[model samples]
Target chain A: MSPRLYVDFVRRLGNMTLQVRLAIDTEILVLFGPSGAGKTQTLQAIAGLATPDSGLISLDDTIFFQRVPGKPVINLPARRRRIGYVFQQYALFPHMNALENVAFPLAGRRDARERAMELLERMHLAYLAHRMPHELSGGQQQRVAIARALATEPRVLLFDESFSALDRPIRERLHEEIRALQAEHRLIVVYVTHNLDDAFAVGHRLAVIRDGRIEQIGRIDDVFIRPANQRVLDILGIPNAIRARVVEVGPSGALLDWDGVALEAPLLNAPPGAQVMAYIRPEDIRLIYPDRPLSRIVGTNHLDATVVERRMGRHVHRLRVALPDGRQIEAVYPASSYATMSLAPGERVRLALRKESIVVIAVHSDPPPIEEEPRLDRAKCADGCPKSDPAPVSPSPS
Target chain B: MNWPAFWLSLQVTAVASVIILVIGLACALLLVRVHFPLKILVETAIMLPLVLPPSVIGYYLLLAFGRGSPLFEWFNLRILFTWQAAVAASVVVGLPLMVQSSRAALANVDPVLENAARTLGASEVRIFWRITLPLARRGILAGMILGSARALGEFGATLMITGNIPGRTQTLPVAIYDAVQAQRYADAHLMVLVMTALAFAGLLLARQLEPPTPGRRADQSAKASV
Candidate 1:
């Protein structure tokens, strides 16, 4: 099928306004972002639930909204559009049975009951046809929602934090179910999620949104590997960032004086005398002993550091290394490597970064803002004084 | 028994209750769903009839339909002092009750249900009819019954709009007033008995829709919330 699903619009939430220019017809485009990112806002705009201030939204050849020099009218109510929106809450009608809720749109029509029963059967909710939404489990409700949306066979499907409500195992199984459903229906799915694992699992393409803009939109692996800026590198959970300067530039790649390690980074277009910060994913960095050949052969951007902290996660050990310059960088090694290295906190080690793995960004950065002011506390005289108990006071006359 | 006045009162209350129910529900839907520039002002306006005294409400209706008024020509359309005038009075008194109860009912509905209904391809009108109207049926019933009871209790507004014209304007309330003035104690007592029975029935209906108090049953709340 031709690429007909396209969304070009601008919408606002709070003080932040999101402007999205996108075109996707047959792919599962997962909007990846932190909470309060414009991921869900963009989907709401496409669904016509949230109106854009000015812009055009076109799905296929039909124009849903437009703002131009001569023409100014640009609004469409949600019903006029044929988007199947699955709310974060399944939102099943409480009064109706599972079958009746599934067949609700078909109500007031001939054969509505039979059609509803058919839909419920597909969702494996036929047995629960007489049951209300509260009677069903979280996973069952999700299936019912999916079945209801597909009842009309809509062109595009929008899921806003849909699986975030379910239990973990159920969430995983639902992903497979959704994928199978998407393949069978060939429907264009625009899923908005804050979970990285879910985005990578189901998304054909990932759009990372930050501060009301599309920071980067590309294939999932590409965005994860090469984030465009420091903000994205930090947002995507990259652990190690080191300050460096450009020493050599080339057409093939540039040599970075990354903390005096002469790192052969495959990024360029920077003048030789520029100060940069290289971002590296922790998984790429290897913790090697001083005697290793790889540690000895390092020329560009290598750090002789001592491990200051070790954290054991589900699948890997997170080691925090403090370089000689008093800057810390983190690296993740397989759990198996833990036995060989005999690594522990405060042990000295050598760290290495792959030439292509280091993403060098320009120097200026803004620190996160503090929302609340700091208050000074006086000495406390009682037990449970400072930790558990707050400041005790006599009642002021009301 | 004064069957004519009894039947006339029932008819006026039923017809007026129907009109108030429809208009009040429409206003409630507007207040709940649509966002207008003067939303607060419109809400205050819809509820204005509630707080206004029956005498003040009658005075305003009389002015609009009274002779020597601009709209008096339309009064020549046979509304003033007719049985239709009693229905009009009922409409005035019944409006606030209808609007308030319907708004409460509509407000209780989960927005998710409406959104889900829309995405499932049901039109806006269909969602209201099938999903909203049905779910709020008990509230709607209570609102109408309250309006009916209010119309039954109407005295000042009815007297001002439609003077006591027996078999036409002499509803049970109006008839009772006329009986007491003429020193017909037995007649007034009989009308009182009938009015009390009807009032009790309305109270029964209103009680049926008592809106289930908070935290009693989750199922009841879900049903009420649509």
Candidate 2:
């Protein structure tokens, strides 16, 4: 059986109390949050660098840290934990060359040097084994640090924003490499990154942490498409969170009454007259082309809107549109489409919102945002939304 | 030129410098890495000799190691008016320089690197030996050189505690004072020149161990030419 890392702890840090609980298996679980969200602290706790006030942390059958009021405290020292951690700064020993650094933890082993060289080769850093940390580039140094961390054959590998400092291409390549490494070793990995792209590129599951607490944890697509609470929605930075009420529900779907505008959304378990927040991404709002056939845009909630404002982004143009009710909604169009359509302020256009694109989150209950059932109304959504693909309404870049 | 005094000063300073390095580093490590109550009080006590007059320090050491003090009464260490007393005075005067410099050097070593070593499965002893010591070597060396220089030039404290016993307790500085008192201008001038030259050499060595600055990189690279 594959190993599992279970962490449940509460630690008071000055004014902030970090109470975290997680169970990670062989797959990578990305801890996603803003800065100071206790993601690094969680990693520290797991690595045995930080002791918790009172809780139990275990990996498989081994107890890593345990502190109960009446029981004998069992806090393992960091050196004994056998967990690998790659810090943001790499923290390579400035004086030691790459080979020596990797060989440091292998002191008692007879084949320490050979094993370290092999680890370097595994990281594709064999040629730079003699180089000091300052002589290597950031990514090269990072790889050396990884090689050093792997020398001990740790049970779990924790990376704290390890790729945020690299260029986009290098970062993406490393993301792929880490995924391959995790699979090859079958090691449980926990990655902490505040960057959304980093989280998506490397994570098999995502845990959204906020204010020292996990707001939601689920498969990446589920959390993005159907956030459990207002906090999770806000952290995802979804641009449109419109106040609405559930007006009607059927096997087909639920009808949401936004400020004087009715929007068709995925089937919700919520009752009618319940206050809800309908979250829609700007890219999800599609502009209906008059020249295209109506069949292509069928089953979408169609609305007449006048462009109140337009702003140019690097690749997309953001159009702030006003419904006949005077309520404004933001939609994004590709620069190519905006240019071809010659869209401008004060121009009247039709917008289409796929029912699957709208996520209706209840304002109250504020329950944990995991284990949400499939909210997709398959019968009505099968044609417009692909079950596996998230953000189905947004056109693929290719 | 008071050759015996010159030799005695070298012996006292060498012995004192070695003791200072060991104790100073231990104190420095404690100050930088440990957390305990009254830490500020300990730090102030260590630094007191740096600012206090050598005579006042001598007075305190006298009482502590004097006739009725615990060190003398219990251990019966009759070090007064001996070369050992001169060594003690040199150590007392030189220790503050060593501790302050070593503390700064140890503090400058990034704690993050130590934590990284800890996570990498290195014990505290290994981390100190492999990581902390090497990284802080330059500053610590500089501190040792400075402390040695201070010990070599020690006159006031040695005079108060050991008295000016020619060919025994009289260090170079004290010997120079004795020569000038007897109106031996030539002997005083020669001893003074020797002391100044030794101090200058020590200071230059200490300066060489200083961390390189941006403006000095070109100079260092030229010197290294590696």
Query: Compared with the true structure, what per-residue lDDT tens digits does model 2 show for residues A262-308?
Result: 88887766668766655666777777777866655335789999998
Clashing pairs in 2: none
Q: Each candidate: what lDDT?
A: 0.72, 0.81
Candidate DockQ values, in order, are 0.24, 0.25
After superposition on all C-alphas, the RMSD of every candidate to the true structure, in Å, is 14.6, 10.7
Best by DockQ: 2
Deviation from native of the Cα of residue A377 in model 2, angstroms: 24
Residue A296 Cα positional deviation in candidate 2, in Å, after optimal superposition = 22
Superposition error at A195 for model 2 (Å): 0.3
Clashing pairs in 1: A261-A300, A261-A301, A261-A302, A262-A300, A262-A301, A263-A300, A263-A301
TM-scores of all predicted structures: 0.70, 0.78
Worst 10 residues of 2 chain B by lDDT: B217-226
Query: Over the stretch A1-398, how does candidate 1's per-residue lDDT look in tens digits?
Result: 55477777777667788878888766688888887777767876787766788788887877777775598686667777878888677777767767777777666678878887887787777888888877899889878888778777778888888888788668767777776677677778888887776775577678888878888887664565567887887676656656667777787777777655677776565567665555665666665555555533233446688888999877567898888878777877665563657567788887766564575533212221244221111111111111111112212101
